[model samples]
Target chain A: MTLLTIVLLAVITFTTRYLFLHPSLPVKLGPKMVSFLNFSAPAVLTAIWVPIIFVHEGELNVNPLNPFVLSATIAVIISAKTKNIYWTVGVSLAVFVAMKFFL
Target chain B: MLTKKQATIKMIQKGIIDMLPLNLAVIPWGILCGSLAIQRDFTVLEALLMPMIVFAGAAQLVATELIAENAPLLTILFTVFIISSRHFLYGLALRQKLKVLPLKKRVALGFVLTDELFALSTDKKSLKGKLRLTYGVSAGFSFYFSWLFFNIVGIVAGAYLPDLTTLGLDFAIAVTFIALVIPTITSLPVLVAVCVSGVLSVVLKLMGWELDLVIASLVGMYSGYLTLRFTNQNQLNEPEK
Candidate 1:
């Protein structure tokens, strides 16, 4: 069952990716649509990350002591400043680990 | 002093070198995904094969989480499909440059076309024809290799190590998403879209929606689109006034 799911999922993903590769494909996205598509990455990623930080097991946990809030803030600052994924992940992971042990 | 063959090899090497910086970030995420797969009770072979076949970090992680929750197969497939739908935009943007390649090479390139690879290969001046193809191959394969290697290491480490989830390593997934998102919030539309989608996701989840992420993402994209349209209209009206 799992294998089937993976294969089916891969097929769907590959087909979507290959949608515009062929010239004969009739799908043409207008500039407005393209602009809309451009927001998909940020929108989807934010949606995924926000719940992970603010909600734990279906409950809101935005207190000061929530390790994720602090760690995510540090990660965002480092990522925004340095524009480097390595530093963002490293600093965030360290902060998270420290908070887990100490706080 | 380099022959023609050596020059081509040099181009490929440069492609790999260019991708090295991005791999620094990819490695940890790959490892985290691998460990999560083990925790989710995926077999060693299944975990190893996923990166090779799927090659999508965010989608693969989401799949593992869904599988662990015993979500329906259809739901898992749908979620991953939506998560990776952005690749279609990448493919469309690359169509002009890629049209010059033969069908076989185009298919090959399409299979491994990632965000990093697309960004690196899209430059018209630096890469052309055979060089572009070679660059794509080299960049794609190196990423593939390291991604798989780190995943294997993570699986092994997860097996021997205590519960990694307790260590808050799972939060690394969220961190990865943060790293991906923060760099892209440069404009008002994007900012509004992100905030709207994020808030909607939390609200929908609180309301016990089945697919809150997917719905929130679509609404967010639409909201961003509307904002872009409104801003463009305002700019046009200012020119007349």
Candidate 2:
């Protein structure tokens, strides 16, 4: 069962990646479609992070004391202020460790 | 004094070297994924196979989370499909550049395509024909190995260390993702898309929607598209104001 799950998931991932990559497919995305697809990165990132940061044990934990919330908030500020990925990840991780230590 | 083979090797080396810096992000992400898989009760063999077979960092992480919750197989498949759907866009974006390659080469390249690889490919000045192929393949291979290696490290570490979740290590994934998304929020439409998607996902999850991520992403994409259209029309209608 685990092997089946892994193989099927790989197939799905490969299919999406190969859908438009095939040389013989003759796929040409319209400008509107391109514009819509352009938002995929931010939209997907937001979708993934929201639950990770906001939810705890199937419940919404929005309090400021939530370590994930506080650390994530600091991560955002550091990310924006530095606009450097290394700093964003580094400083926020430090802040997260500090939060874990104190709270 | 360089032979043709030597020049090819040089280009491939350049590709790997250029990609090394991005490993900063990939390394941690891979380790976290490996550890998370183990924490979620994946056998070490299963954890290792996942990176080799699935080869997607974010999607694999999501899969581990869903598996921990014992979600239905169908739900896991559907959610992974939604998360990986973005790769379709990457393939679309690269179609023209890759069109000249043979079918076999195209398929091989597509198999290893990742967000970082795609970004690296597009961010460069044009390199035609064989050089492009060699460079891209080498870079992809470099990243692939680095990812797999770190997963092994994470698995070993997960085995020996105390539970990492207690140390808040899983939070690294969210931090990495936040770092990735922040630089992309350069315009109003993108900002709107992110905020809308973020809020909607939390709300949907709060409401017990298992597919909240998928739905929120689609809505966010549409909203961003609409915002851009509305902004364009307003500018057209009031060029003098």
TM-score top scorer? 2
lDDT of 1 at A101: 88
RMSD of 1: 4.5
At residue A78, candidate 1 shows an lDDT of: 92
Which TM-score values does chain B get in all models? 0.70, 0.71
Runs of candidate 2 exceeding 4 Å displacement: B1-22, B26-29, B32-46, B58-83, B92-100, B115-140, B165-167, B238-241
Among these predicted structures, which one has the highest DockQ?
2
Question: Per-residue lDDT of B1-241 in model 1, one digit per residue for the tens?
Answer: 9887998899789878877755665666778888888878998888886787877777888898898899998788888887777677667666656655778877777777776665455344533667667877888778778888888888888676555444444577678768767887787888889889999989987887766877888899889878877887787765211
Off by over 4 Å in 1: A1-6, B1-22, B26-29, B32-44, B58-101, B113-139, B165-167, B208-211, B238-241
DockQ of each: 0.53, 0.59
Docking class of 2: medium
TM-scores of chain A across candidates:
0.76, 0.82
Q: Write the per-residue lDDT of candidate 2 for residues B49-133, one digit (tens) a residue.
A: 8899899877898888887888899998998997787677677767767766788888788887877676566433433578878
* Candidate 1 accuracy as lDDT: 0.76
**lDDT (Cα, 0-100) at A1 in candidate 1:** 77
Best by lDDT: 2
On residues A1-103, what C-alpha lDDT tens digit does candidate 1 reach at each position? 7877777767876776666787677766676665666677777667778887888878887786689988998998998898777788888888888988896
